[model samples]
Target: MSMSTLLAIMGLLLSAIPAATFLRNLPLFLFQPCKANHAGNVKVSVLIPARNEEESITECVESVLKSRNVEIEVVVLDDHSADATADRVAEIAASDSRVRCVNGKPLPENWNGKQYACYQLAAEAGFHWLLFLDADVRLSDTAVSNLVQRMQRTNVALLSSFPHQETGTILEKLLIPLMHYVLLGFLPFARMRMSKSPAYAAGCGQLFLTKKGDYKSAGTHEAIRSSRHDGLKLPRIYRKANLATDVIDGSDLARCRMYRSGGEVIRGLLKNATEGIASPVLIVPFSMLFIGANVVPIVALVLAIIAKSTLGIVVATAAVFVSLLPRVMAARSLKQPWIGVVLHSLSIVIFIAIQWIALAQQLIGRRTAWRGRVS
Candidate 1:
């Protein structure tokens, strides 16, 4: 309760920032998947799964289609989308034989929808390799080639990229950069690729590339049939299966704005945060510690200053500001808005407010419907 104790806690949290970064980045060892024109006849199947992505499906499909290399097929699996997603893809397929729209089979018990959809897409694909992409992600021209080159070179069973996140909203601006900070700083990609521990696989579903045989070798979609963040787990399976692997910084080759609105961002974040290498048990403790350490000192500083406790105000303000430095550094990378810096402090406060909302949502078996499908 004393100012010194508060400052000490803030110091611990601030120190933990680097440790988190180290822990995360320690295992993400990626060498970039490369295809050096070795056996130029390599066939690639770009698999896209859509449920209700009418807003972005066409563009996503089109972007990949434009990358028509030697042997490439853009297989868009329509996962029973209620929207015109299927029709739109079908329309594109009708005109271009290379663009095929396969109907996604119904979801099986205990299987997550996207994984099942990806499985179905794989079954329909007749290529040497499979590239899984979300309907909302827009790929750069060299995205596939870049990953292909890396995969071919390293022979990784599976390779995935964490695309550069694009953010706009106040929430996205505030929390989205934390993702990259957590990823690059906490879980370095270098360590993730080298270790077989499931924790090492930190991939984004937006861009997953694997040799069709390697995918099948590692049990394919069957392994992570129930996972919500399999994107971050596939590489581990590959390593366990003895498949040589490599991943790279695909910021140049890939870009995605994961969610659309502020509410959607929060919900989507909570949906994955509980599952993404972070434990629900730690949430409350982390939040409480942050509040007690940083929030309390700052508040105490304000009150103390009003009561003429000059030393108290200076001491608390300096500790709180220094503690917030890590978050401030993280916020600068977001490039969204300046208010995000202030919101960065609110993270613990906001997280505390919605701790149960997040925990209960996952614990009570409540399903989150994101991007039009019930998750």
Candidate 2:
């Protein structure tokens, strides 16, 4: 309303530029999938933890086997899938020994399903390196070799990659990029690998590559067996163990569509959003900030224009554009649709709401399901 407040708003808007620049390196892979290639002979135990991914398991297994040059022993954990997921993996495994389907043991007391399943898989695996992949992920031909080479180049114990999403539905298009953008802002790629902070470690669940020993030394899930978000925990654990770790933008090397429909997308996000956010106290503040940053700017600009507050209108418009630009760039880089940026940028509202919903669920002692397992 006044000159001082308008100037203050402008200053806050301008401050985002430096954050954008610092976070600019996050979209590490613009044309990443095309860059995949086999490095050398490195045996990798490609592990998949499938619960009820029957629809996607067939293609996922096929994609893993289609790799060009790399020794791979694919282990798909049938984590008590009630659906035809186990049958599907069995059928694939029956045809090829390279792709073996292993039944995940029941969730033992005090252990999370994924962690227990992974622990079993690791115990059964006889390989030099381990690669943990989600059942929805479809890999490129040279994905393994490329990851190994990147692993070798970085001299790190763990090399994680953020795969691109294959946005088929409207829901997938809107929400998935929000996941990555928050990850980008919350923990910038350059800073995570460069610094040794465990809080900053981020790995895509779709792709987690690490030396077998490094995995074991980090106590694997034994350290955070209770964690619902391994992607958030593993890299940090590895870093704390004095093992070098790095993450790459794998938009090209791997692709996945996490949920089938909008309702499913909302539930999928709610399952972990509250647990995944920084803290309980930050919940409301973050939600309000999210809404204010995205929706307020546009509404404020319109109101300012009607009220004839020239500086207010100009500042609001500039803030909205500046806030949305990097995320638009992120969506484009991730191969999400052009118009998806609008939803992706506006997603901060949905993001905060889902998180609160998740927190409410957790408090009620209700377990969330993903791929048919309690998350």
Candidate 3:
């Protein structure tokens, strides 16, 4: 094959993978309902680890308190925040008997701040099922009850939900939608459900729900105490120990604004970008796949236009469209901005840059710092 033909073939394969996977997972993303019958007897400890979430702490607590048809206790861990996170939790606790705040212990050596906070919360929790949520996450009135019901029916020891991401700023819109894109486009949820391999394990730390016994047996947050991406790591740890873990679409039940501005988005992603990959050996090829799958097709389309080759144009255009199928579906399902679907190429470019920056930081022995804490 000629050089252009070889490049076109490679682009087609890259595009085909995401297109096929997206189609395979679209049904689950669209129609797999979170309609499990209420499990009234299941008491869930809604654990919140707040470092400096004063702005959203009250809302987060109140939302959990509003949960219906399930027994729940709201426990907020104040992780030595400079803000009034603890005070807000305390205010809620005073008004509601079920809501309480616990002062987080001093960060021990070799432990991440969030993990330590989670560990303390789990210790104080007086229930069998533990629901770890970020202070920014806001749940619907039926979220807790519905989640419990799903857990009971699935019988998975550890379950997580990908909440609806609320993005405001332009940068947030461009980047946040990629979360679902990477998830549904790459992972075969059917296989992940049946497989016991750690390779297929995935979860979201923003909303992790699991039984106390399984968590303790899998070492809880302590197993991944120092790891940056607990969402990615914790599920693998459970799978490694032969425990069940899986994720579901919780967008209808909860939503969160994870990052406020461009800088926050970059820093937040930097902390866990490298950790998302299993090993350093996979980084190069993983990066290549991202570039090949999303970036190369756009380039090929331009080249075909310049070369005035009709067949090249047709192939390149189809490849580009195929690559975009997942992002378009995700944007609609997740309720992201329509403009983001139009600008998917730009998002891919920025994502690739973030991954490289994280890899570079890892290589140069630089740690990611967040909320006055470095990891």
Candidate 4:
């Protein structure tokens, strides 16, 4: 086979792998596991680890207070913020009996700040079910109630869901939606649901639900104290302890604008990179798959047209279709911007670039800092 034909074949195969996974997982991704017939009577402690979240603290607390059909107490652990995060929580506490603000203890040696705050919050919680929610995430009125119902029904030890990512800037539109694409495209939802293996464990740290007893037994945040990416870490910890961890659809139930600007988005992703796809073992393989599947086909298609290679054109066209369709479907289902659909390939290029950059930083012993803390 000609080199052009060989490249086209490679692209077609690589693109089809993720396309198949996306198709198989699309229904599971879009399904609202939070919507159910039974209203939750479960009492849950909604724990928020706040550091410099003054702007969103009130809104986050108020939204949780709006949760219906469930008994919930909102606990905001102020992680020694430079802002008015504690004051805002205190104001809410004064008005509402269910809301309380607690000052977080000093960071322990080798512990990630957020993880320590969560450990403290878990200690203060006065309920059987504990929910570790991010301060920026705003839950719908029925979100907590329905989430509990689903967790109880499934009998999973830990449950998490990716909230609706609200993006406004051009860079945000291009980058944030890739989270869903990477997740639904690569991770097999069926295997994740059927196994307690740490290999299949996946979650979102923004929202985690677990029974208090299970969390204590699993060692919770203390087990992964130094790790920044709790989404993957916490789930693996649970699975390693012979417990099941599952991810559900939260796009309809909660919304969060993770980063305010493009710079923040880059830094935030960099901070999360080491524990995810940016490691030495995973980076090269992912780089090959990402470039082969998304970039090669488009370039080969144009070259084939220029050279009039019919075989190259046929396989390259199939590759392009298979690679692009998953993004289109995800955009529609997740309510992502249309811009991501038009520039899917470029987005992958930038996404992979960030991963490699993160890996380089990790190797050199340089750490990315966030919220006045270094990781």
Candidate 5:
């Protein structure tokens, strides 16, 4: 084959891999049904680590308190917030005995702020299961009960759910849906559940559910205290300790507005993007693969039109369709904006740029600044 033909074939293969993986893992993204009622006696501590999260803390706590069919204590740890995050939690605590706010101890030299806060919350929790949640995540009335029932049914020690991300800004719309795309496209969800390898483990830190024993056995947040990507790290830690862990679609059960504006979205993602990768050695190749798989097809389509090459046009069209299949499926399944699916190429471009910026920052040994703190 000619060089141009070879490049076209390569692009087609790159796009087809993700599309095939997504099709095979379609069942994993289906909306998980909540049991009519949970009969388990498992008491859960819904732990939240808040730093300058005054706006969302109250809503997060209240939503947890709404959970039914499960005994739950909503514990919010104020990580020395500059705002009234603790006071907001305390306000809710005064009216509802199930809600309580605790002052977080200062971060030690070895610990990340959120991880240290979670460790302190775990210490204060008096429950069989520890459900560590982000302050911005809001759970439905049956979310906790459903999660517990699923855990019992699967017989897994660690379980996490990717919450439905709420996006408003253009940047948020372009980027947030990539979360589900990456999970379904890159990872084989079925293998992740069946395999015992740490390589297959993955979770969302926004809503993690684990038994107290499993948490302890896996060394909890302390094991990954220095790491920024707890979502990716915690699951590996559990698998390494011979514990079962898996993630589920929590779109119906919970939702979170991860970032408010374009600037916030960039900053929030930059902090953990580099740390999510296993090694720096894979960065260059992965970047190339990402661009080739998602971007090259679009470029080829333009070139095909210019050259009036029928074969190139057909291959480039197929490549674009395959690359977009996963994103379209994810957007529809997760109830994300359809506009994002239509502009999928723009989203991938922005995603590639973000990854490069994150890698650059990491190489320079620049500390990640988040919520008025650097780590």
Candidate 6:
């Protein structure tokens, strides 16, 4: 085949893989299970691990306090915050009987700060059902109730939902939606549900719900004490211990702006990289997949147009369409910004670059820092 033809074919293959996977997973993601009918209220301990989260703690606690049809005690672990994170929680606690702030113990040797805080919170929890929520996450009045009902209906040991990502800045709009794209485009929902394989494990760290017994049996945050990506590691640990975990669409129920400024966005993603796509085993293959799927098709289309190759244009056009369809559909489903859909390819390039940079930093004995702690 000629150069243009070869490039076109390569682009088609790269684009088709994720397109097919996204199509397979989209329906499953959109299929929110029917809420199981119950008589009593869902009694859950809403656990929040906050380290320098003063700005978000009050809102987080208030949102949980607003939860309807659920009997919940909100426990906020103030993890050695230099700021007023604990004071904010305390302020909320003073007005509400269900809210209390706990002082986190000193960080143990070789433990991730967040994980250590979560472990402490889990130990202090009084309820059977536990929901580990981040300070930045805001839930609708019915979110906890719906989560409990859905978990009861599905009968899974752990249930997680990637909340509706709220973005504000231009960089945030361009990048944050890729979280959904990566998830739906790669993970096969049918296989994930059918198999308890650790390889199929996936989740969002911002929101996780599980029975206290199951969490303890699976080793909880203690199992992933040193790991930064609890979402991935915790799910894998549960699966390894022969427990089933599942995810649902949580757009209407919960939302979080994970990072505020562009700089924060970069650092937050970097902090998560080594545990995720930036790892030694995954970095290279994922780099190629990300580039080929997101970049090559656009480049091929440009080249084909310049060269006036009809066959090239046709194939590259199909490839571009195949590549963008998933992002367009996901943006609509997840209520993400349209700018991300438009800048999909560019976002992938920047994202992949960050992954490589993270890997390099790791190799050089450098670690990610967030909330005044290093990972």
As a TM-score, model 2 comes out at 0.91
Candidate 6 C-alpha lDDT tens digits along 1-375: 457667878988988888999999988987353355341556899999999998898888999999877899999999989999988888888889899899999999999999999999999898999999999999988888888887887889999998888899988998888877888999999999999999999999999999999998898898999999998999999999999999878988888989999999899889879988999999999989888888888888888888888988898888888889898898777788888888999999999999999999999999879988894
Clash count for each candidate, listed in order shown: 34, 1, 0, 0, 0, 0
Best by lDDT: 4
- Candidate 2 lDDT score relative to the true structure: 0.74
Better of 5 and 6 by lDDT: 6
- 1 or 6: which has the higher TM-score? 6
- The ten-residue window of minimal lDDT in model 1 covers 26-35
TM-score of 6: 0.97
Each prediction's Cα lDDT score?
Answer: 0.68, 0.74, 0.85, 0.90, 0.85, 0.89
lDDT of 2 at 156: 90
Put down candidate 2 lDDT per residue, 1-375, tens digits, no spaces: 665336437534643643375356554533343354667778989888887788999999999999877899999888888799988888988889898888887788777788778888887787888988888888988888888887887789888887777766776676777766666655566666677777777776668898888898988878878777777788889878877777777776888777778878887777656556734877876665556556566666666777778788678767777667657667556666766667644566667767877888778877677656574
Q: Candidate 3 residues 1-375, lDDT tens each?
A: 335545666788997887799888877655244555467678989999999899999999999999888899999999988999988988888888999898888999999898889999999999998999999999998888887777888899898998889988888998988877778778998998888789988888899999999999888899989987888888999999899898888888899999999999989888888887423776677678878888888888888788877777788888788888887777676677877878888888898788888888889888789999885
For model 5, residues 49-107, the per-residue Cα lDDT tens digits are: 99999899988888998888889898889999999998898888889898888898878
RMSD of each: 4.1, 2.7, 1.6, 1.3, 1.5, 1.4
Pull out the clashing pairs in model 3: none
lDDT of 1: 0.68
Q: Which stretches of candidate 6 lie over 4 Å from their true place?
A: 31-39
Q: Could you tell me which 10 consecutive residues in candidate 4 have the lowest summed lDDT? A: 31-40
Candidate 3 positional error at 263, Å: 0.6
What lDDT does model 5 reach? 0.85
Error of 6 at 339 (Å): 1.0
Residues 1-375, candidate 1, lDDT per residue (tens digit)? 555545544554554554456445433432333444333566789999888888888898888876634467999888888889989988898888889887877788898888898888889888888899988788776577767766665666777776767887777777666555445554555555556665565666677888777788888887888777776656667777876555555665667888888898777766655665335767766566556644665666666666666666666666666555556654443333556556655755565555557677777877666656555
